[model samples]
Target: EQVKVSKQNFLLGRGERLTDDIVIKGGGGPKEPPYTFGEARRRLSPMVSETSSRIDELPQAACPGDEAVISLTINPEYVAKSFFPHELMRDVGIEVIGSRPKKTVPEKRSRGREPSEVFTTELFARGRRAAIRNWSQQLPDWRSDRGSANALISIEEISAPVPHAKIKGSLPEQGRMALETVLHASELEFSMIQAFAAYLESQGIEADLGHSFFAKGLCFLELDAPVERADDIALFTGVRTLRQMPSLRILRPTVRSADIPTTDLELPTEGPVSEDVRVAIFDGGVPENHALTQWTSRLELPGMLPATEGFLSHGVGVTSAALFGHIDTKVPLPRPYANIDHYRVLDEAPGQDPHKLYEILGRIEGVLSSQEYDFINLSLGPCLPIEDDDVHAWTAVLDDRLSRVSTLAMIAVGNGGEGDSILGLDRVQVPSDCVNALAIGACDTPGKDWQRAPYSSKGPGRSPGLVKPDLVDFGGEFSRPFVVVAPDATPSLTTTGGTSFAAPSVLRLGTGIRAHFGSNLNHLAIRTLLVHTCEEGDQDHKENHKEIGWGRVARSLDDIILCDDDTVRVVYQGEISPAKYIRAAIPVPADPMSGMVTIKATICYKTQTDPHHPGNYTQAGLEVTFRPNDSKYSRNNQVHPNSASFFGSSLPGATEDELRRDAWKWENCLHAVQRKRGSSLINPCFDIHYNARLEGRNFAPPESLSYAMVVSIHAKGVADLYDQVVRQYATQIEPLRPVLEMPIRT
Candidate 1:
């Protein structure tokens, strides 16, 4: 359906005629790509047996005598039957373990189409000699003619037998295994740890539990056992042997402390603060007597020890940056844009218990559920880098919580990016991999000559390479650090540099947007605005692209949302139902003398996550298309000839297919077409279509899945397009006014 465009008279004094035949193509063309029997059979071959005779011809290794953990690939068509895999496993005496959508390399044919996807679930079963063999024998009979009562495609072992000699090298010398285990949230009360402990005791083994975490369907356990008993635990609790094996083990993490340099710069004792926007800072404890304490409400969660001098620096620095704008001792300190609510969750004592770090997840959940805040800043994150195959509990929990709650969480991408080490590059620390969080990396000040801070992390990010550090901000550069108030009564200041400081800078911007927009703006809208305003300078510097995603975000909210005389900016915030599209029409300048018009659009949305499936973590994605009013591109046309040329010109000679693959179909955020004339032989309007899809999932998305889109049109070297559009579509376009600051009360 067409979005209503308000009608208003435009005073077109210039001798330029308006195009009368403006048309909008209604719906997207059929999305399904034609499938062939040969292709389907080839794709299904790895998982499906043709007949009972074929099952008998399987390799001998497929029928192991003892129990094993195996991965079963199921057809996408059969996934809707919720009871299919469970019942089949029960019938076969196999236990269903953790499951994730199988990651398939996108084929050329898969481009521009939402292809049907498949899933692979890890399963544990014993008596494979009997159960699997029997099932294979009866497969032909169960599928008489054309019945699929059984959804089992193919099963392959996931666990490999470790040689007894090599097992010693794999286990710790002290018999301690710092594991990061995952337990189903629903089964937390079942106490799998106790069960495993009992099993170990029966085998004459002794162990000690180090650290454990339980929150919202996730459990992380750390165990210390005798070195000799490691094999038994590995064999018994293996995903192949039992379903209770840890999802991942914390093997030799490269943890480094943030290098905080101290300075004698003194901070102002008082500054202006606004209560209109409330921000929660989750980091090391903020000292109550600190100079910024007057503007901050500090609370220490249960089990948090009193802040020590060393621990106070990181949290205080982060909190100060968040409350007050980036600290520049060269100028008068800027007043805080929002009231602060700080939650202390980190303790950095030497040789502190590792368990405390793991437990921070629960305390964070407590604060998020119990407290109310518009924005949450997590300047503290584990130094461990995330794996492509696994999603850490910290990342999963934050993504789940933030998407459900109204609050937006900004996370630091860690300070591990220093040094010439290969591990330091493109490695975003845990939780920073969180797709929902606004992960920020550090860049040097004066973003125009923007350089990623030597210590700022980079990313191809978690699996499938979703962009991390969604954007960058001026944190501080080498030799020159951001200065902030120290946690001392003397009003002393300190210098620090890291993504930790970078995150709060975004927080400052967020609070400003919230304060200006009031309650009308949502997190997705705020995120859209931030990313939409990001200025990626000098596209020729391709090396810096990944290090500084999208480039540094514009510091001023007014600069992002408000338009100059030649440009008209329109923001759309609403929800789109699953598998549906929403269309908005843009009124082109009526003055044919409008010269060259550039249209840039950005779309951002938050999706419910399936952490187990990091490969397809975002369950929902928005597909957007901008169709200019040109007769050359008809409603039924598959390719827009003008679109190809426009993209080729704007994207530096990119092919039509490459442009379609990168900007239009692949990414969730689409920004394209910067310089096309308004008076070119075409229709007088452009249509923006948003289509939301439930990617790689069997079910539909929830009813209220929100999304925000920002579309701005600029008339280069011509009349004021903003006034013209405002005069023409007064009801449809509402200009965002700059926030007027009230007099500060000291």
Candidate 2:
């Protein structure tokens, strides 16, 4: 057979870090303000008094000396650590243990205000109850005495953790629950929590830390106690949120669907797949001796894991999807993209086990801590939906683990879109909110006519990670079910429909991309490329971002890597020091061109997280500024050039929320396109500045961050643009070619 040539996009490191400054300089900025001391005291005194009074009438009584959690809402502007009310808290003898960013809609909207514009992240402090009553009685005078320290004037409100912070709905008087305690990991705090647990044990209530994990500086643990007891536990200064653990609430564990017609499918011919690529599926246990054995192996824990029929079946289907994709009944089954190791993380009583969330995560974490994989797909997570004011243990631990290694994880956004949206039950589930991983949602079908599957979760995920279900792929629908290998010993197929299958299907594609492009394209670059070449079709103009996100993944590998005649795509993979700026120039033809040109770019990076700060979850952010012409200067600022809209601009006629500091600026996956006349372009480039924060406040020193960018330029009537770019930047950039045979599927 004649070998066909392939045109490949290239990588570049043309931008270099700064070595020396032409001139020495120092800089400072004017500070943003909050409320004045007197007004703030006047507004907060009543709240404190009411809370002080209310605390006495609670299910649990708080002795003046007993530790209690009091929430102090602060002015939005004073969120930085420097602006924290530390001095005042010390004066009042109350220690501020922890804080999370919050956004509240002003009761009254101004004439031009949208919710996003009207709300910026405000700080809600967890204060250890100390002299709060005395402080309330003389609130106005104490802050005044400190004069400059009255920065506590930022206090907007004081209350017992608000009603919304607690577990919602009713639960049996004695039921199993999970308690999230606000502890910042100190010997003193740990002792307090241990003592509380001991007290609970004395009462015969179970408060085990065996399966516990920390989130947002809070410890979440399994507890078996009465509803009244749960309420009393909330009184402790360390506890923040509580939830009723569901019984047998397994998600996607049952592969429910219409039975498929008998079909013949062949397993991939056993041979060495690209040794460079590694993939894994963290799900229920797959059936023993399944036909997928050629390319799939189970990572069994120390002992034999117990499994139910449903779990095994669901596991087989999920692993099958990762290996074979939505099996095509029309043609012969294709070879597996890359050999995958399936970890039987979930066993027989996962859903029935209240502490299963932690156990499952522990298993997954243990595997990640040892073996490394290039790609991983998780089709299951907690049945609970994500919350704005909180971070779940599963999400925090997984995100932290992923950040330390070079791995691309895909999470099913969940199959709860049909749930009640008004109550947010229909939103993306926990762990998928992870800023470091791709949260996959299912579209109804595999064709261009597809829409988000009715059961696939939706999302306007929490800000800073607003875009959710990173990309959609065909999971399956009742009308058109997804076919996968069954749990039967012999090669067989079954029908299913859910986001569980959608996630691995996409992972299969990623591994295939890695197999084709070789190691030159790391996981981050592959992520950037997948998101960059997304096909939105009519969705490009839809207001369904909350549902479809960046739109569906291109089904075929060719669509993603192959470029059009007038288009040229380049990938930038590098690291930048914290608080420094780097330029990523948009590749274009050498000569001045005519007609209109469109530039589409997607930038992706992983961040070390602060689970304690849901409002400021990601510790790193990139402030990308697009400057189209080097010679043009803004009239207001002479030193820097003029800038134009790129990633952060709102769509036409869109009433986008004005988030405090613009949440989009910190989003990990940023995709946007702009069309302009070719003549206006003159060395256009994006200036990216990395911003670092810790515990919702600036840090003294920051670490370097890794980032990948996929930018493509398409010029009308410029048939030779790709050739021109390749020739002009010959020394700087080269094509990313296949290191092995490219798989062919028709």
Give the C-alpha miss distance for residue 15 in model 1, angstroms.
Answer: 30
Clashes within 3 Å, all models in order = 5, 7
lDDT string, candidate 1, 341-367, tens digits: 888776545334555556677788888
Provide TM-scores for the models: 0.76, 0.89
For model 2, what is the error of residue 643's alpha carbon versus the real structure, in angstroms, after optimal superposition?
0.3
lDDT of each: 0.57, 0.72
The 10 consecutive residues of candidate 2 with the worst lDDT sum are: 16-25
Best by lDDT: 2
Model 1 stretches with alpha carbons more than 4 Å out: 1-69, 73-133, 140-144, 149-173, 183-194, 209-218, 227-231, 236-273, 348-351, 419-426, 463-465, 591-594, 634-674, 680-695, 742-746
Question: Alpha-carbon error at 490 in model 1, in Å?
Answer: 1.6
Question: Which predicted model would earn the best TM-score?
Answer: 2
In terms of TM-score, how similar is model 2 to the real structure? Answer: 0.89
Off by over 4 Å in 2: 1-35, 46-67, 77-95, 101-138, 142-150, 162-165, 173-189, 199-210, 247-263, 540-542, 651-660, 743-746
